[model samples]
Target: MDHFLTFSLLSLLLSFAAAGDFSDDQLIRQVVPEEEQSVNLLNADHHFSLFKAKFGKSYSDEKEHDYRFSVFKANLLRAKRNQLLDPSAEHGVTQFSDLTPTEFKQRYLGLKTPAFLESAQKAPILPTNNLPEDFDWRDKGAVTGVKNQGSCGSCWSFSTTGALEGAHFLATGELISLSEQQLVDCDHECDQDGVCDAGCNGGLMNTAFQYTVKAGGLQLEKDYPYTGRDGKCQFDKNKIAASVANYSVVSVDEDQIAANLVKNGPLAVGINAAWMQTYVKGVSCPYICSKNRLDHGVLLVGYGAAGYAPIRFKEKPYWIIKNSWGESWGEDGYYKICRGQTHDICGVDSMVSTVAAFQSTSE
Candidate 1:
């Protein structure tokens, strides 16, 4: 039994090490959740009650309530470990405090393995030497308000539309909320490996981009709206508020990703949302996140370096991400991750894609 446990841990460590960021997993990875910590342990019962009342979480019976309470307690411990591993960020009970990790991943995460395209266009290399010290699409009136994905695994659709929304805004100088429901109900394209852009099951951002191109673009949120569930396709070709003229995949380099974000628009990227389940706020920079196993799709809004410490090299650079979980989570429906200040933390920098141009649409 001890040998099996050791082997399992070694395999997990090797998975994390494959990204070529760290040689010693023990130095940053928190394998044991109950390890001694410098911070105060949270009052589980008190927090659990508060979580229930805040989220309006009511179970059918006492048995289910007890089960959920136990899950919430376990999540508190997990949050402590996350807090320790990501000391730069705040971690605690969230709306999903009652859910187990599997439940959370099932309902929230929705990114599948990116499909290799036969003719996928690569984003042209842009100059990054004169990039600004801080950049955010929200500040430029390019990004729309944060929306919710509910209990559906349709985050990829939201991420796909988000990049297009920004691209459309940059092209037409109009910020219009696009539709995720359009993609959720419509896009069912499959790759050679059988990986598809499933509605609520899971999907990839690049695949959704491909679908958007073939479908003649997407409608506005007010025109199509989002239901957060699978439904019949009610697409209207005449109501395409944002149409993709062309799209391209950015390189894995961090500076280039930022350059694309600044020059083009918000870039759609994938991320490992394991730590995000209990994330409260601040900047999340975990030391032991899987870079290759990205499960959730989000938008790369901007990048900045400041707060919590000296603004210079003393702290790792942080990227601002726009999540689809509504304004109740993280920094007003956004997440910040510092990949040891790298571009590939949680695989955010790996599968980056953006709409290079949008078909001209006049007001």
Candidate 2:
């Protein structure tokens, strides 16, 4: 009986491993249409190799969670499909791959731009205020994460809607996961494709905020779901909110961040994703993510000095940030950038508007 029980346990472990199993070929076949499978196999292999080199050893039994497996498989499938659909697409591999390994290291992990140097030179000095200890802003409610605009380069829209959704909740005391699709379709104030111009480049959140406020707020996600690339402007009046305030940026230091912890809630800030190494908990620097350009934006919620070093909590010390890349990625729907780096790369010192009377008075 004892032998049988041990064998059963071993078999269970084996089945679990096999259930999560996948290979480069299988991923390619699953993602790429049959017609283009052969033509894209090499590219698929190259992408797979790169992914393995970067993250293969990182995943072990101890860290094997269902979501982790799902993300891995999903990303692999995405890469395969991307390769087939846009074989000539230079952004994913060449754009990022062409970088000399050294350049890649410098771009992602090393901090080239001096921290707070640019902001300090221009912005007026403001008193450092901490977030409220019991601030309910972070708990406003769940936000639906979004997919990367991919080569479309509509990060500005995502950032704008992400911040606006939170601000809307903070002001109204009701959480509404608004739609980026509405902004993409209706916002013509910007350039073509409603992507704020098709440079596949970058944009500012301030512009998006202005567009929303002038347009009398936005619609909920249900009314106008994401339809990928830009489509004709469509406004659903019933889904519109009454109003939305202009978003703001704040800068604080360690002490001030702590104080603000007792004052406000989450704050949105531009994160330099160039240095995002493995995001596994307890892992410090030596980042291995791409160094191309810091093209992404995220929210910063709170800060903490708890760990050996301070960690930014989107929900705690880690500021609960909302990512544009759908709910399937990162800590549920967001990612956490480590704080205390003093560079404020994670926008630890940055600020966002809240519903609190204090924030209104300060404004």
Query: Candidates' lDDT values, in order?
Result: 0.80, 0.43
Stretches off by above 4 angstroms in model 1 are 1-30, 33-42, 115-118, 309-313, 359-363
lDDT of 2 by residue, 177-286 (tens): 66667666666454232434222234444445556666777777677777656677788665575355444434355445444333443433545443222232332221
- Summed backbone clashes in each candidate are 0, 38
Q: Which number leads on lDDT?
A: 1
Candidate number achieving the greatest TM-score relative to the actual structure: 1
For model 2 the local lDDT of residue 132 reads 45
* TM-score versus the correct structure, for each prediction: 0.88, 0.52
Angstrom error at residue 137, model 1: 0.8
Please report how far candidate 2 places residue 194 from its true position, in Å.
15
Model 2 TM-score, all chains together: 0.52
